[model samples]
Target: MDVEYLHHGVPLADYQLTKADRRRQDEAAQVHEWVQRQLAKAPPWSEERWERMRQLLGPPVPPWELQRWQLRLYCGHVVEATRSRERPRPDGGVCDEERCPECGMDPAVIVAFEPPANNHSPKSSRFARRPPSDRRSKAELVAENNALRAELKSLRGQA
Candidate 1:
């Protein structure tokens, strides 16, 4: 008379045991099972830990404000085009429109023109180009710094 081991009300031979199952006979399987149990019983993320992570990551970035424009395509189809407020169109506005999908036309006329509600005023120096900067190499910068220091020392000595 043979007595079969029972697994969850089923015969142990018929029941399938995975590597991580506590019922598995192998040493590696037993270790895997212990590890899974340890993980399950592990402590959850603490508020301090969460705060530290947030500090390391810094502040969350604000979502981009998108502007939608109604455009009349050359194919007589009206469609909407969306763009971020930070981006400027060819006309220096945020009303860049895409071509008509139906007719495959390149340019489309804007149906409704609404200026972007930008929170910050446009910079006056936006179009004004700065005078070309004197490009000096690293070696030139070090030489200039040394010369300036020498001149300062000479001036102090003269005083």
Candidate 2:
């Protein structure tokens, strides 16, 4: 029998991986399998974890006392007017009113939430249709205009 020289602690002929290398590869495979299983598992939302998440997000706002409400659909879509029922037209035909324009579902079936804004009055949809803002009343705007005119007049007189 003839023996070949060894290079880098490995035999030149019939080269084979060492026992330590085989054990290391097996350990690496086990670690990779464990990581894959962990990734596949869903997040465990225990009561404590849920409570912590709640703490991060403040308490829910009170629902508006409006007959109509803006709804956030389960599919993450939002639409205005939730409770408005369709009415018949003068020609004795069904009105072309739709509860939800996006999903074409009735207001009752869609998941609804009060719009997260308080600028609009709860009793009326007219204000809700308008943008949410602290707009000045017509009287206030007139008063401001008059005040500005008077100031301009006074400045001109002084000049």
Candidate 3:
């Protein structure tokens, strides 16, 4: 049998075919022929296939679903928020912001209660004997502060 050889659509001489090169060329030709046969055998798109695809895909989802209520930030800015599929809706319907986008104030550090002064305490001895309000060591506090600063820096960089 006689065969014409081509490399990237350009004609090649028979002398160009080394033993390894011939094996590679044969493998490539077999792969191309297999792909062509597979493509020819593939079923054509039909209404049945389309319906099956839709069924598998389920309902179309919107980019975001608007919540029934709005989010009230610590900065007093009211913004419309989207409801997450993974998380359940808030009990109050509205969600409170941890960090205000408008004023850039983080509500996470807000102090809910302050320890009464030594003299102002009804039980002075009990209050005096009580442990420090913040039990964290100086090193721990510094580490926490550094971590928070780093996080803030990264967040600012992203913005």
Candidate 4:
């Protein structure tokens, strides 16, 4: 791949980010936050464990709050255990599936990927369309259920 295609006219060393570039970075951060919020609300169910999750990740955390200091915590155990005599991903590094930090389950079934960040308030399709995160937290689920019920009643009235 040609590096010039990516850098453009700016010299490799003189790559000072412009205001527009900064704004784009900000936008990306916002979108990522939105995605995380959605995931937190509607964590994927584990068919094997048959449990909501081993533990809750607590209230939503915006990436902006963490800044770059934030480290990508891979799932439980190293992908490989120690470099050993000869191993591809020595020292239990991240695996392909990316399991949990606590439990060694590929994709974790709990932790999920963040979505493209945006400044505008992010709305989950599940909630907007059918409230996929109905029963995440008890309080929120109740609120969602109530809203759904109200909508159903209103629709019935029209009918």
The candidate maximizing TM-score is 4
Q: Candidate 2 residues 1-159, lDDT tens each? A: 111211121122223445654564455456656877997896867999989999999876434422333444333355554232221111113311224567653322222244335323332445343334667789999999999999999999999
Clashing pairs in 1: none
Query: TM-score ranking from best to worst?
Result: 4, 1, 2, 3
lDDT of 1 by residue, 17-55 (tens): 343332222443355568879989999889999999999
Q: Write the per-residue lDDT of candidate 4 for residues 1-159, one digit (tens) a residue.
A: 101111121222333445654464455456656877898999667775553343354555544222111112232132211111122221123322333355643342111122122211113222223345443778877999999999999999999
Full-model lDDT for every candidate: 0.46, 0.44, 0.43, 0.36
Query: Which runs in model 3 stand beyond 4 Å of their true positions?
Result: 1-69, 85-88, 91-96, 108-159
lDDT agreement of model 4 with the native: 0.36
The alpha-carbon RMSD values of the candidates against the true structure, listed in the order shown, are 27.8, 28.3, 30.8, 20.8
Q: What is the TM-score of each predicted model, taking all chains together? A: 0.24, 0.23, 0.21, 0.26
Question: Which window of 10 residues has the lowest lDDT sum in candidate 2?
Answer: 1-10
Off by over 4 Å in 1: 1-86, 90-134
Among all candidates shown, the one with the greatest lDDT: 1
* Candidate 1 local Cα displacement, residue 135, angstroms: 3.2
State how far residue 135 of model 3 sits from its true place (Å): 63
